[model samples]
Target: MELKNKDNNSNSGNKQINAMTEGNPVRLILVFAFPMLVGNVFQQLYNMVDSIVVGNYVGKIALAAVGTGFPLIFMMASLFIGLGIGATILIAQYVGAGDIENVKKTCQTIYTAMILGAIPISILGLFLCEPILNLINTPADTLPMAKQYMMIIFAGLLGAIGYNMNTGILQGFGDSKSSLLFLVIATGINIALDLLFVVVFGWGVAGVAIATIIAQAFSWIFGLVYMRKKYEVLNFQILKFYFNRDIFVKILKLGLPTGIQQMLFSIGIMSIQSLVNSYGSDFIAGFNAANKIDMFAFMPIQSFSNAVTTYTGQNIGAGRMDRVHSGTVAAVTMSVIVCLLALVIIPLGPPLLGLFNSDSAVIESGMIYLKNVMPLYVLLAIVFVINAVVRGAGESVVPMIGAIVTLWLGRIPSAYYIAYNFGKEYMFYSYGIGWFFWLMITGPYYLSGKWKTKSQKLIRQ
Candidate 1:
């Protein structure tokens, strides 16, 4: 009878098993990614909707104003986003290792971020808005509207910082679903407000900007609530309004590369936008529409990359090197599948482009742009997935350096040369050529197993 007592009474075993299978990895990836996909769609929708509203209601010049200002705003926003990336990575490692104390401390870094990153950018957005606009060579007709829109959006910089910080914290804790939910709610509100204010109320660009700021504020609130209620480790009581030097330095070290990468990437896009401006409004509108469509196709890749980064970060911290390797393989496989599907849908580019504008000229131009760029999705997917893996492994510096060098030295120079020396029509090649070149450069660095080695050493240090 005593020999029959074979059942294990330990709850630790059960907990470990549950943790291992919390959600099927594939299912978890999809669940985490779907909301982001929807949010991204809505994000693109708002921008596209803004263009449609303004182009049809206000005028093409206003539409161009909104479109041109996007890259500039993105450049400014990239700094905060970069800092958020740093926070996410550090939080993810702590989460993976099951270290609650560090997670709470990491959360406090948001205060540091507010002081060191957000406040400075917000001030720049307010005071330097007009001068920056002029420096970017904004057209005379569009300058006033652009300045109006930029100032209003920048006025709500605190909200943007809140959104970024909260999302990063949630993502680090393996709760991407909450972040996605907030995005969905915010995006829906944004669209409704956009229509009510811009179309019915005749508020123009300022209305659209106001709508976005309000929506972002709501997202930040929801994110805060979710963290307080759901995340057991994130303690609001410990949050200080002042900075912590050690935490600040750690956050900056991890985040600075990502921020620089984003800044440089935006700079590269601005450079291209400058070139497009020379081609006239038709090309600019077409380019903007095409870029929106590209964002849709790119959303899945971005989502997967985010998931992989978190997954890899946690596993690396847990010393589960086997899982880390497996997770990477899974991520790359998923990315390839998505990219392949995109290749089949590439021919539908014209139809998608037409949704943004019925103008035959714009549609034709967008079609040309998409058709030329679509086949490169496979390459892009590989590049993105690998970059995420690198970032997750805490080898951000190499990737950041590669991106800067490729974008500035390879892409920008080639773009200038092709557009000016070869022919304006050759500008599209610059995009493909840059991706192809960087893929080649990055592939070896990744394959050499350097990132994995470097990451192991980093964790030890």
Candidate 2:
């Protein structure tokens, strides 16, 4: 009866939860993806709200300070998220196999592992933030505020890390709705706090960081309560929790590449950011505004990528390769539609950049970035959609290689060499060149049907 009530709350009367492993390919992917899309948008908006408030009120310096620290923050943050994705893939497979006990064990293990890991990470982040900022040649004007912002965010690392891991666990079981609900609640709270701390309290950059931390804490806490209430299989017993060496080993093997890929990706961006920093604050501010806008363009593909990940994870776990194939086709179609829709914002780019910061130079620079990158989003869309299938098959290393190689080998080298000799505008084109080669390298692997063999063998494990 309790489980029945939970089902009713989530699925409602006529509408049932979209089960990825057992439905029409296109419809299932869309239904499963909608809530995630909304959640991601809200997440991005919450980030945007920080810039909007800070840029409009605290000034561009504050905005620049916040923007400067983010890539560094995300570098570490993505490590945990990638680790969760590893857990998600394994859990999805276990759930698909109807191994309820193992699913519970996996959940407990991930929870325990992350909790143990967060403390050291948080401390290290706080200690490292300043040194790294200095290394990036962060301007003296912004350094103090940037350190303040980055440290506070680190102090609350548990909330951010835990929340993402919970989202991953839920997604693994095809429960996107709950994570969306939690995100909605958190984002609403975040927006309200943004106004209170930044405007009402005059806390500036620190205020936004505080708001984000509290909001993340709310989501993680609420996620725990919900899981305990709804899932008998999700109950966390301290005494029952022991190191599952086998599960931990599996999670690391499949997921470490993802974590490495993201860390290296962020490192590559940091490398570029170090160069961007040398140009001065106006350029940094403009890069931030353009990146904020770029998130809107990229978020859809990310949403679809996540949907495909969950879809492929669940279906492959259920031994439904046919569903995986059809779903990939549908995901690619959805991705193209989203990429086209994002283009509408391109012509509106100048005004949007201006909204973030009214400086003429900042506006013009940001517009250049949007115009160059946004049009080529379709190429990016193709790589993301196809990679989703590859990752869901637990062939994470393959895509990870494709990503790191493209960034370090292609994007980084080209960006630096071009900027050093010719100019920066040409450097932006390297973004496309990188994606094109990435697609060329990875797209064929997907078509070759190698991942299908890997997925088939995974079931036997």
Candidate 3:
């Protein structure tokens, strides 16, 4: 009847949804993933709408300014987001084990995270925004606009970090529904603010950035209230601002690799962005549009992957290896179906790309990127699910190593070489080739049975 026992039973392929307080893993996962997906879509929509509005109202240069700052912004925020991953896994394990004490301790760690992680990043982001833009080779014309936009976004780093931490806790506790609700609310507010500030008031990129930060702050505050009120285990008063060495080490052990992996991945994107910048603003705009579309196509797989991580962490904590296996099967199956759908639907890329731009040149370039990238969606789905499963099973090292090898050894270097030596057109091929290489490298990590052993060791230890 306990949460851990129920999780164990469910893992044995038992057909009971209500047995686990967390609910049926598949249904629970799907339901949880759906909102998260919607939220992700809306999050993308927030950016896409900004681009559409700016591209039409502000001009291509302003749009490019928004686009140029994305990698840099992501790179700055990656650490906290990566830390959230660590928090999620650890919190899920503790929640599954029904350890109220550790759960509260983990909640307190958020305070440490706020001070140690978010504040510093915010300061760094604000002070270095312009220099970073220059370093990334932002066009002289776009530099001022990019710096203006990024400065506003960075000034609100606390909101971003808070939302991430709050969402991480909710998801970790198997309450992903709340996380989704908060995101939707935030997204709605962001859109409204975007319209008011940009169109009505003529604020431009700064307007959109302010809207985003305000929404993020609202979501974080709302999520915090909910956690304190509903979850007895997460009451904020228990959140003493003290550093527990053991807790810190445990968090870093799991979180640091995932964080570094994300940071490295962002770096690779930034590297690619540098290549795109050389080609001109038209290419940059096209790349940004394609990136947004790709993110939409990728949403379901990402949602399901997060589901797998939570499902696997809880089940593994409860010593339900068989259930973990079954859950992985379900996740991978769902991911493959989504990927196939993407493969079928990607030919509409040109139309979708055109929605953001009226320019024939931008649409044409975007279509080329899609054609090269879409077929690999199927491969990426497998890679995503497998990687999630491994991480869920507490095998961070393999996934980290796989990510490093794939991005550095394959993606970034190939993108640089092809873009510089081969030609601009070869950039598309570089993207495809990098994904293919990722599939090759990461597949073995998933299949080696090493994750199972490592997970068992973690649980036993």
Top-lDDT structure, candidate number: 2
**Off by more than 4 A, model 2:** 1-18, 237-241
By TM-score, rank the candidates, best first.
2, 3, 1
RMSD of each candidate relative to the true structure: 5.1, 3.7, 3.9
lDDT tens readout by residue for model 1, 1-461: 00011142222211211121133567666666666667677667767777777766776666667787777788888877888888877777765665555566778766556655666787787887787777766767778998898888888877777887887877776666677778778878888898899899999989888998999899888777866766544536534554556766766777889988999998888887787777766677777778777776688888888877777677676676566656667767887787778875567877777666777777776765677677777777788878887887777887788788778877788888988887665667777778877788778888888888755554344
> Which digits, one per residue and each the tens of the lDDT, describe model 2 over residues 152-232?
999999998988998988888777888888899999999999999999999999999999999999999998888666666
Candidate 3, residues 96-117: lDDT per residue as tens digits? 6655566567768755766677
Candidate 2 Cα deviation (angstroms), residue 3 = 12
For each candidate in turn, the TM-score is 0.90, 0.94, 0.92
What are the lDDT scores of the predictions, listed in order? 0.73, 0.83, 0.76
Residue pairs in steric clash, candidate 1? none
Query: Candidate 2, 117: how far from true, in Å?
Result: 0.4
What's the TM for model 2? 0.94
Best by TM-score: 2
**lDDT score of model 3?**
0.76
